[model samples]
Target: MAAPAHTFTHDGIAFGGDYNPEQWHPSVWEEDVALMREAGVDLVAINIFGWAAVEPRSGEFTFASLDRVIELLHAAGIRVNLGTGTASPPAWLTLAHPEILPIAEDGTTRYPGGRQAWCPSSPAFRTAALSLVRAVAERFGSHPAVALWHVSNELGCHNALCYCDQSAAAFRRWLRARYNSIDALNAAWGTAFWSQTYSDWDEILPPRAALSARNPGQALDFHRFSSDELLDYYRAEAAVIRDLSDVPVTTNFMVAAHIENMDYWQWAGEMDVVANDHYLDYRLGDPRTELSFAADLSRGLALGSPWLLMEHSTGAVNWQPINFAKSPGQMLRNSLTHVARGADAVCFFQWRASLQGSEKFHSAMLPHAGTDSELWREVVELGAILSKLDEVAGSRVVADIALVFSWESWWAADAESRPSTAIGYLDQVHAVYAAFAALHMTMDVVAPGADLSEYKLVVVPGLHLVRNEEAAIINDWIADGGTALVTFFSGIVDENDRVWAGGYTGPFRDALGVAVEEFAPLAPDSRVSLDSGATGTKWSERMRVTTAEVVDAFADGPAAGSPAITRNRWGSGNAWYLSTLLEPEEYRSLALQLAAEAGVDSPVRVSGDAEGAVEVVRRRGDLASYVFAINHSNTSVQLQVSGTELITGDNNAGHNTAGHNTAGDNTVATVEVPPGAVRIIREESAS
Candidate 1:
């Protein structure tokens, strides 16, 4: 498979990260730039939070501080990713137009002390923000240092939803454009049941706090509008940047596990290049798996294009309750893992640790201890490593398996009045994704509506809201010999969050050859075993088989002997319906079995003699295939593969160290990958 298309203004993988030189004095700028060059920092993201510094007052702009920083970096031969600094409006703008402030659902307005305090729907905020963007672009658009235009810092980070009158008015306008009329809005929002029918367009309001339960359809639409509102904000800034500068534009996406509201798949189309900021949640989940999930999702948003790792912490982040620092070598491993997943640029949150303000404690390349710190040494070492691995840039991970993940379904399923509140959309999806990861499989976390024909196996887990057109796409893909595994609570609602009248799993009932009679939500203490030895918890559905054969039955439960797992052949393809959430091992077994049935395997498979500790990922470039052997366990792993180690000089005997088929025959070799280390090898072909 060919790699996805990407535009690179720089030749090699760009490093360095958010550099707030304005925070420090002008005297510190020279030393900072010198240190960055010594550490192999080629790129620095600047002006991210410089709204107040650039434009101190209304209708006035000054770029002396920013100009000095840019010049210093440019003189040092370090490229700049110019940020628009529109994410946080200046204090004067907010004070002049207080209406631009975002109001919470509880009717409290957010002040300008914190960032992202402006309402996305506020016209004044948009005008002010665009004016600043235009000013900045006009000033530095053609500058030799400016390589990329960062639209805004993580758009809609805090002000995703605004319940104020301005937002309500904007929401009504958006609804008018979408539904066209009040009657259409009423129908789409299902307002008749609650006697909440709208008589006039002015009668409609933003889904705010109410004494009674809010409309799910209204909330869903609000979610869509909020996401679009932020996208519009990004587009507005990007439009100005494009008009003034030919540089590529991007906004850092917070694709962390906790990010909600914004639909990145739709937002990806508006960006010149996709960039993501991922922060690991050490308190809740394993950092490695979370990083893998975020990076894969980001790459998928770019359509397998080499995206930017815009922001990540070198160690502890200040915002989390427990700011745990990374151990030795953890940061390097984290950076390499992102590269293995398709991130061309590996960057961090900031270059230097803050001495004051909220993020003073957050770790950075230059920590509080400066050059004397071990973190600083590690940062220099990682910079050296990235400088050497330039050959791996722009390569794409080749995967025959695709996991369909949707933010819309995540919102709908998590909405109130569901089959079970315990049904986490990502949790279900992650269980399946983790199983694939354990098997060293390279899978893309694609959108539900993306092109699926390229993938041999597609897994859709907990897709609660299935639009008619999306269902048709999946059904057509299955009929065309594509293997699909869809789980419970899927195909329940339509595009407007309305349930199909006949039964659950509306559009999927016919496709899966099974009809869900009712949802049997298991208690926390409850358990059910499948005939396939898969124990299910949290959820199970009672279904009656129609044209499908039962692959697994509920061994014991309220729905005992019912079809828990069914398989049906449609046209030339097959569809598997997992009616319950299975354990990781069982899910892995089922996933592997289905993959084998579909004739899908990882690009590089480990020998059977070794346990599955080292994970392998293959990315194909124009010249060769890049294989990443990552040891995630605490012990060493022996990996036998046909490739040349790109980082380390060591290679197994009897194999071509040049990574070419010199004798017209392939050679196999075994090497021990140490725990928590990564080995990137280059093979001639992906096969």
Candidate 2:
């Protein structure tokens, strides 16, 4: 793959993670440093929660211990990513300024039991946070070892919507900025339907249970407003840090964190580099579903910029009722998956496990047993491997397909009472994603307003909340000969979750050439067969083709004979409507068929006999392309390669049962991979 437009140099994939030396005695500091060296640790992110220690009272400051930690790491040749200790507030500040504690939506003030309990919109919290941030930056901004500045650890607030008076005032201001005038706001919110129109901004408050009815429009706006408010808080802290520090600043974001409405695209603009904390449930079929999705999201957020794997557990997390170890090769495979996706570096949640506090049981490189544990050995081995694979750092993945995933539309759709209670926003989108994954097709998950001209095919599934401008963009794309595949429950509502009144799909009715008169919710076990000899699973929408050709319909329902799939030709493009939820096989077959028609290339075609766990991603460049063939299963499987394996430092002469043989060695080889193995091959020539 071609290197990114901007080159960032790191010795190798960044190792080491949240390192807190404050809990340990000074005598153990030497041991910690030695252990880090043994494990090939190079970067140490320090002082993530030292607000109380840094400033005990209003303006009192002390940095004696912190200064020593910095000096020690610097002298040891270790890079530092300094953190502003603003995630937690001192007890005194919370006690004196009770407003600093977040107020729940139910009008209850939260007690300080956990981290991330501070109210984002609270002026008192912001003031105290800024004081400590400015102090930390001034002291360590120019430190020779510091490479980056981490602001506020994991900025997701537990109490997402603060119904406090301060938040109430902010919500009003946010609404004004969005609508510009009360008349437009009234129309957008459909306030005329329920006598809910606002005469003045002062009268508006957050859509709390006490002041509002269960209106989807009201609820949707509140979500948008709350997200904006939290973003403002993040920006406030970042502004203070940037003023005092020359180093790049960033904070860890949870990828699927929906309540925050933090447009990763917008958030990435303020950050020097994007970072995220990803945790997975092994039972969720395949970790690749969530892992690859997040990586794509992060890459898109950075506009193809590399991201940081901020946190992953070295062992099992105690928080989950049943703490399970990442079975043998699981951790290694998961970590490599991140690097393969586009992460510049990989790090875990902690270096040493804490002896006290809620996260004490969390996994670490140096476990509670001190050292010499299996977990520690694995960490060391992985770190050694990263030291060797430094060339892959800063490489980019070139993709031809883009999947449209709009957070705003997702939030708005779920906010309303839809036709099917079973039709969840994430699940519907994941269905389409699962189809693409099953076909082993590389897809770029993009936001609403991303440039679509580069992509030959775009798949938009269940786009229920079509904001005003989005329709025009889609229309233009279709008019320009772009092929778009849209599924059921699309183009039903505007930005605020209000039903588009002109027709079922207001602005898109003509483009789709279909009118959805009624929607039918399917039972959990219900099934429907399409006229194209394809079966559908769960949920179907009944609609008529106004100007398009119907290819399929429901086998049974009140509107059983109605169109289930439609195809229309607009300008130079073709628009397809999937009026019902499709079975996995059906969705995959249709997606691949459409992709073929659009002239998009499908790389890495695995034969039927090839089994066990496997994944493939292609990275293209002007001159040549690189294909990554990874075997995530326990047993080996055969694979065809046209070039060499970068990881094993081998040359591929031909397929072997034991996998590709190494250079300068004569060994019979088959693509027989052991559990959790990876291979990187560069295409001999571009297609």
Candidate 3:
């Protein structure tokens, strides 16, 4: 068999999670280790929030406890992912340096009651954080068991806009670097309209609720500034660790996290690898939506390279309004989903449940009673399965489809009201994603400026803030035979949120072969059917088709029978224009037609029954490939497995027919997969 492209070769997928020995006694360490061994846990992320213990005073530090924990784990033959412990500042640091406390939007200083309360622009916080990181690195940089360096916990503040004096000053500097001149800034911000032009750097302030009616340009810049400030803090801490050690460093970013602009593309460059926390309410059916987007984003961050699954709740999250427990096979399936989607390792928010504090009710390997529970058994089983498939670890799966996910576009489009409030930036992106998901088409969600040569089809959901260079790049790709999907509300603004005055889509008008004259935001209950004979709801954009053919049209409203969806042919490529919010069914139908045009094949042959309840991911090599089918439903479903089951080692289950290869082939072999069950098939060489 051909060597797998992306697989976990080291015993199995790394199992174990965030371990906080500081919260427990030394006597409890032995028991925790034993429980970990029982659960086949080989890796432990240690010292995530142990800053208080690591640094007791300003200059004085203590590494004795941490040293002992690392030594013990190493002795037990377990790998350690050492954390810098800078996420939550110690009480003393906060009390001594009052600037560390972030200033809320109302200009009120927030007390340090919760973590992530530190002001990113605070010099005292930076100095103290860098000192502790340097100390940790100096002590354990070369530890034998150390595998990676985790920078901080989550790296997001509940209240993001810090209107403090320090933040305000930093925002001015950031704006200066971006705009260069006050006149340029004024022109870009259109401050002449509101008479809010700035005379000096000090006159500028952090955009807050108190100053709601400020210039859109200034407010947008403040958002970017705040994000950059926090990113600087992350970089500062990362630099400290890198100065002492060569181990890869990363901070866990929340999926769909909208705090400080955190452009993953820029942030991914600073760290050796990218990791993200995955927390979705199963009730919302958003796990498939969020995780798929997140996995693709992480993969895109490293240019299709594998990423770490840093933090996930094993069972229930206490923070949500209603804590729902993962069903019997749900946790295992979720972990495998991460691996199938390009995760290098699988770890959770916690290894052991906390006895006291806010996370006491959170689920973990060892429950609050300190006994081995179902969650522990599931963790062990997953570890064992990973061990058996160790050869598949560390391999990468190449994607032929790329969906454009831009932070700049999201920021700019949402900054001002143009089309409709119901059609949010994320919602539009997710609509395209849901379409792909329904068709069982695997795609990579990427940022702007990502390489377009690898993907045959490129979907830009909301390219609202298309820069001239980026637009040229897209046009070139389309001219070179790439199928481009551009949606409504796109090309409305430039990098500075300035409307592309000449036309709606700016430079993309010629590439799309169409011009949008006006936007029509439909009512919530509005309905429209396509001329291609499909129906949808919510909103639609009215456009004058310059050269494009109307593939679908609006069925109702003032613009009824108008072009709701258009197709334009440029060079040997095709451009699809969606002029409205499509219902789920309409989206799937249109997606199927687009996929066909792009020459992308669906992995799942049978559909409708398993529509959104299952997801398919394929990792292809030159000759062979592996297909993973995941059932995200709450009930068991039948899957026709033409290839042999990779995990079962049972080729007899599926039928063997003439003219078929050794991997097992059948016209139709119905395999009943339980809810949350993941099945992997090793496809035979097509050659």
* TM-scores of all predicted structures: 0.95, 0.92, 0.93
Once fitted onto the true fold, the runs of candidate 1 whose alpha carbons sit more than 4 angstroms away are: 1-6, 607-611, 651-667
Q: lDDT for every model?
A: 0.85, 0.75, 0.76
Error of 1 at 382 (Å): 1.0
TM-score leaderboard ranking: 1, 3, 2
Pick by lDDT: 1 or 2, better one: 1
Clash totals in order: 0, 9, 12
Where is model 2 more than 4 Å wrong at Cα?
A: 1-9, 210-213, 257-260, 282-287, 321-323, 608-612, 620-625, 652-672, 682-687
Residue-level lDDT tens digits of model 1 in 431-472: 888888878888898887779988899998889988888888
The TM-score that candidate 3 achieves is 0.93
**In lDDT terms, which candidate is top?**
1
Ranking by lDDT: 1, 3, 2
RMSD for each of the candidates: 3.2, 4.1, 3.9
Point out the higher-scoring one by lDDT: 2 or 3: 3
Range of the 10 consecutive residues with the lowest summed lDDT in candidate 2: 1-10
Candidate 2, residues 539-625: lDDT per residue as tens digits? 676678888888788777655898888888888888888877787778878888788878875565553343424766776545556
